[model samples]
Target: MTDVKPSCLEGIDANGTDSESAVERTGAKPAEMVRFTATPEKNGATVESENASQLDQATLMATRPNGGWKAWLQVACGFSLMFNTYGLINTFGIYQNYYTEQFRFDPSRASLIGGLQSFLLFFANGAAGPLYDAGYTRLLVVTGTILIVFGTMMQSLCTEYWQFILAESLCIGFGGGLTSFLSPTVLSTYFTTLYPLAQGIAASGAGVGGIILPIVYRELEPKIGFPWTVRVIGFILLATLLLPVLFLQPRMIPGAGRKFIDKTAFTDWPFVVFLCGNFIYLLGAFTPFFYVEVYAVQNKIASADLGFYIISTMNAASAIGRILPNFVSSYIGPFNMLLLSSISTFVFAFAFEGAHNVASLIVVSAFYGGVTGLFFALQPVVVIGLCPDPKLIGTRVGIALGFISFAVLASNPIAGAIQSRGGFVGVWLWAGVTTAVGTGVMSVSRLMKTKSNFFMKV
Candidate 1:
């Protein structure tokens, strides 16, 4: 056997003195050595020396995220992206009302248009993610900005059903997808410890936009007509998108050789389980937002103006929901927060069935908004945790969201069809059942992750 020398030890020198002896000789307290120690029986002196060198190199190469003004700026840019993408999607009820009233389409047809928009917004991300990973983030943002502005402007001139579908559903939806996919993915690179809080603040911008845009449309549409009101909204998007163009950045250099779709991620069972649960959860996720205003009008719970306010009220509550739950989620894992939000959403969907008056309607809307906000804010973080490689986060998130987009696409129109057959009761019951099923699936995913450890943060 080779003899072990003090010089081969992690915290020893060529003088055959270890750190502890040196400390004592110099009358100094022992300091922790930042090196790996290897057992003599397991590895010889040469192997131990190599292990120590490898550990030193790893320490030198490791880089923690730089959280400062630059990082928060990325958060702000993420806020702007959410404001334009999900913000508008959340307020589709306002558009659905306008289209059915103006163009004389049935509720299902109107819902179909909104659902198509949501589908594109989510599905297009599959391509956008790979593009971003390949170093096209700037291109994606610029192209998306142009399409969204152009599409929104074109919407002002549309009168026919096909025209609206082309401008609103296809162009704007595709544009929103480009920006939305890049925003959170880039923001996540700037944080590890404070990720949940950063994402929550970024997502709260959607709540703020949801509250403001509906009120803007309600007040503007009456005075300037639908055409100019839409034009005004388009201009606001132009102004807000500038922030992302200027400030949104990625820390990793573009990996041009990397494939857009990472096939390896498919083998991660935990991630696969999470994706299945997410799809089920999203099936009923937006049902309330899409139909709540119409449901209120149908049930005589509120007037037209008050029905509009209901959307805003829910979004106002969502602003609080987005921030608080995320901050708390830092202490308890994101999956725990997601499980709680899923359970609460399941309960509140049932509350919609019991709502007969304006008071109960508003209460249920607020409560549902709060829980859903938690779902949205924590979603990206949960996916990040399951990801094995940080470089592939964009691709993984994009593909998962692309699959979930199908559920979002079909949900609203399905809810409308159910309402047509069974009235408001049918809609509420469908929403409740789907949400409950989603909750159960999510619970199973949690169990799979933690092996039924009820108190584990994961």
Candidate 2:
């Protein structure tokens, strides 16, 4: 029998012990270690034998394709997935408006349709993660693509509330959740050193999609009518989604006998704390995106025509924010970037309420989108860093995002209630306060992980 020391396990815990010990401490069954030591010398394989020194594992990690045609192609695959999923969700407001105007439906009821879609978009992540770990990448992406395309087509024919809910919310949202979570999880396996940068580039697709899709809707609906315009959007998604479905592949082996729940992840204090901080941050993170244009129109700071494009401007700026900060994060560490962005976001939350003019409103929207965009891009990378087992990245991140889905679902209604009672100022104040608390929580998590080493890159 080949003797592999327990001390040389795949992942290191916060206590400086190997992941084997951490797994034992958590009472999880012994999982298969990474095959780095024995795999052939191709792609990411290292020449080190199973009996080689602990450096064997490190060598395997260092062999990742940081930047190459194949690796960059994977990044493109991730971008396509993001564009088809979250990017589509970003344009829901336009559909909500159309539904309310054409059918004279209650605004709150119409909002439910979009809210349900957004909720399931993340909520299905719990199952999505485990499925990915089990080597179901193609299944998830293929099924999700079919659902989204079919749902969009069905949405064109719907005239009733329940029909829209079934076609638009349930089908699209659940499909999006299944596919969206795969992007970061897959990217983590391809480029260890430039993971954050690659992920940022992929995530920028959301901002790009956000900017373009709404424009497509706004310009097309007038010229082609609602049904054909939606069909056109569906065609765009179909063309884009086919790329990821055909090309995106996982670089790592499937986890052998991985569990669905992954309780070991929750046992880690730093990860637990970080997960809580993320949930709290999400509770208010989307308030500005949700209401920036509303604030512009209601306050008469901008005309409806100009206000229509405020979100587009914000999303365009966010594309820059998503890519540039992430490139820097590769050197500074994702955790450090997370803290900086969280603090900046808190400041911007308050600044948003103080904007009393069109120029100021547009500027605040731009800056806020940039800051929050950094947070969005950094989140999955942070989750991957905190996890002890490389195999658990998908499950743990899925759990983290799935937990936060409730916050995204309720964020708008909570802000609306505050608006009714106290107006936009109260809403902004709430956003700032929640974000500040979340930042403080993440700071504590960082301190715990680094053992108070202020200079540490982590």
Candidate 3:
């Protein structure tokens, strides 16, 4: 075949060159040969090609997500993983009440165990992300399942404070963290446009778990006692965990030679500012989650069983909160939705301080659950938006989560101490003030990014 330059193929019809001659010379089909037009500029003629446009369209179609049974299955697995992990974390208030009553432990001591559990759940994500990147998705899931089962089962046998801390705080916390970190990571692989909504649905599993577990514990404890109640929960966890281990998988091959923590993310000012805001937000975020049952009991607002019902109320509302806000965020922007949710949380915290009666407390719990649920559903998507490079998203999220872990760790114990000193008033005040301040900081960061464009989606 003759080596024909692309320039020679142009204007073949106008220049009276036959189609056969052009095909014979260029070795390209008539459909494949793209036509270009030359336009006069100051320097020379600028050529524009239709072929480039077609190539771009082809690339987009090839990369578009296949949203079918497989993709939805990943979302289902994500839901189960969350149900077994953070869903159990959401039951901390119930456990807090149990530990205090059974062991005669002070609120501060009980909170220490809950706080440590929350800490490890988030803190371990920094390490788990890298392990997922290294192709340990299945390994991490299996190990987390074993640990969660073992920890829950062990909690049945523990009578000492230290033993409770070891089983519930360290073992369960570590296991949940490992499984939770991988849930969203694997789900993201099979989605693109519907990602936020899918993630919201998956994360709503926490709310579902939160509702079921507390109710189970509250009703079962009266008949079967604490040890047996916990054993029942352990069995439930086993059933929930098995689904994810069998189905959840990565869409791509495991990444190799990537650093566990990416230090370069710190160079981005928006991400750094967002991280600080998250830290401040979390300082007060978990207070209600850890103390509401105790607060109700201390104030004589309701009976023990009813107090547990309040937690279930919050979790039920949170399920709606998690799903709806995330779907809205897909249209309005993640940061904007976060700001609104954060403000709502702050407002509810203050309202919770004034809630002296059972009716008021129930109302507050519902609204608070609805508002705060957005934080978990929207946070990962917000972090991903701040990253300059898509490949570095996991690392950036890990670092942010690691930083937030310290805040979660300290928030419960600190609130417990404050409650000890000044009662629930002090705890509520702390939650309201810190969350409001965090919202303010996030607003400022948004301003810095948007400048004067108040209506900008960012």
Q: Pick the candidate with the highest lDDT.
A: 2
Model 2 C-alpha lDDT per residue in residues 6-69, reported as the tens digit of each score: 1112234335555446445645432222232333322321232343333223332323446667
What would the TM-scores of all predictions be?
0.85, 0.88, 0.83
What is residue 234's positional error in candidate 3, in angstroms? 1.1
lDDT of 3 by residue, 200-227 (tens): 8888999999999888887898999999
Model 1 lDDT per residue over 215-293, tens place: 8898899999999999999999999999987766665444448697889878877778788888887888788887888
Check candidate 1 and list the clashing pairs.
Answer: none
Superposed model 3: Cα runs more than 4 Å off: 1-66
TM-score of 2: 0.88
lDDT of 3: 0.75
Q: lDDT of each prediction vs. the true structure?
A: 0.76, 0.81, 0.75
Reference-based lDDT, residue 341, model 1: 90
User: What is the TM-score (0 to 1) of candidate 3?
Assistant: 0.83
Comparing candidate 1 with candidate 3, which one achieves the higher TM-score? 1
Best by TM-score: 2
Error of model 1, residue 378, in angstroms: 0.8
Error of 2 at 457 (Å): 0.5
User: Each candidate: how many clashes?
Assistant: 0, 0, 0
Report lDDT (Cα) of residue 335, candidate 1: 76
Error of 3 at 182 (Å): 2.1
Point out the higher-scoring one by TM-score: 2 or 3: 2
